[model samples]
Target: MQITVNAQPHEITSNTLDAALIELGFASPAVATAVNGAFVARGKRAETPLAEGDRLEVLAPMQGG
Candidate 1:
């Protein structure tokens, strides 16, 4: 399926958010995810379904002074 990740186009075979994150090499537990402008909790990633043209935003925490 084709979806947009962080405003970039990508082709992935994952059906769930969790799978997609793993497929994209974003396996860190500290990362945050949002699908189509809605936040998806860590515990719910496994049940959150993804579709073509969907927008996935992945953000990793950054520490700064």
Candidate 2:
């Protein structure tokens, strides 16, 4: 399916958010996610189903001083 990640379109095979993360090589869900402008919790992404044309925004903590 085709989806947008951070305003960039990407092609993926997984149907769920967890699967998508795995496919993208993310080892953990220590970050927040937004689907089509809606917030998707890390704990809920595993069960959260996604569809085509959906936009996902993944936000992770970054170190700064």
Model 1 per-residue lDDT at 44:
100
Highest lDDT among the candidates is held by which one?
1
Model 1: residues with Cα > 4 Å off, grouped in runs: none
Best TM-score goes to which candidate? 1
**Which lDDT tens digits does candidate 2 get at residues 1-65?**
99988888889999999998788666566778888898987788889998999998888789999
- In Å, residue 35's CA in model 1 sits off its true spot by 0.2
47 Cα displacement, candidate 1 (Å): 0.2
> Model 2, poorest ten-residue lDDT window?
23-32
C-alpha lDDT of candidate 1 relative to the true structure: 0.98
Model 1, span 1-65: residue lDDT tens: 99999999999999999999999999899999999999999999999999999999999999998
- TM-scores of all models? 0.98, 0.89
Checking candidate 2 for backbone clashes, the offending pairs are none
